[model samples]
Target: MLLERDNRLEQPDSFYAGLIAAHDGLSLEQSADLNFRLLLILANQIGRHDVLQAAIAAAREGVTA
Candidate 1:
């Protein structure tokens, strides 16, 4: 399956707020850890190597080291 590129959330603002809220009290390292864990959880739900790879490439598009 191809990675979805559209906004699929029922309430995008609320979800964004909640995601930001989740790191409200976290240190930088803790926030990074939270993001890593969240990525793993969502990736597991996706459960497709090709789709995950596509998503990663899409996410990295225009991003520089």
Candidate 2:
């Protein structure tokens, strides 16, 4: 289970980096839509709504920190 968890978490940073890069070309509405879709994908893969929420909240906090 732990191995599965670790492997699941081990997806390439470049994947998200690519998403961020792609986001740069988007209009505000398009960017918001893309981010929502990406969050849904991530939440499904990670399998925990609270974990997803916490991660997102933490990331937001980090950005402002």
Candidate 3:
């Protein structure tokens, strides 16, 4: 399976808003932790190693340290 690159969310704006809202009142550390936990949960749900690797590579495509 391939990592989906297209917008598949039914309510993309709403999902984005909700994701941002989830960090409300969180400290920097807490927000980072929340994001990691969410990523783990979602990755587990999509349990294919190759797909996850593709997603990781895609996410890092234009990112710099």
Candidate 4:
């Protein structure tokens, strides 16, 4: 699977809304923990070492740069 920009979600609005709603009423620490847990869960589901590493590097670079 290519890891570039794409519009693959069928229900983007609901998905984004749900994601935002998941963080509702949480402090920064709680929100960060929730996001990390969610990332681990989804990353495990992907289950590809190279893709996961590439994704992690790409995401980390964006923030640090």
Candidate 4 structure quality by residue, lDDT tens digits, 1-65:
54757887899999999999999999999999999999999999999899888898888988965
TM-score for each predicted model, relative to the true structure = 0.87, 0.50, 0.86, 0.87
Instruction: Estimate every model's Cα lDDT from 0 to 1.
Output: 0.93, 0.73, 0.93, 0.91
lDDT tens digits, residues 1-65, model 3?
48666788999999999999999999999999999999999999999999999999988997988
Off by over 4 Å in 2: 1-13, 56-65
| Candidate 2 structure, TM-score to reference | 0.50
Candidate 3 ranges with C-alpha deviation above 4 Å? none
Q: What's model 2's lDDT at 33? A: 95
Model 2: clashing residue pairs? none
lDDT of 2 by residue, 1-65 (tens): 21233444345797778767988878999999998897788679888767767777766986855
Greater lDDT among 2 and 4 belongs to 4
Clashing pairs in 3: none
- Give the winner by TM-score: 2 or 4: 4
The alpha-carbon lDDT assigned to residue 7 of candidate 3 equals 83
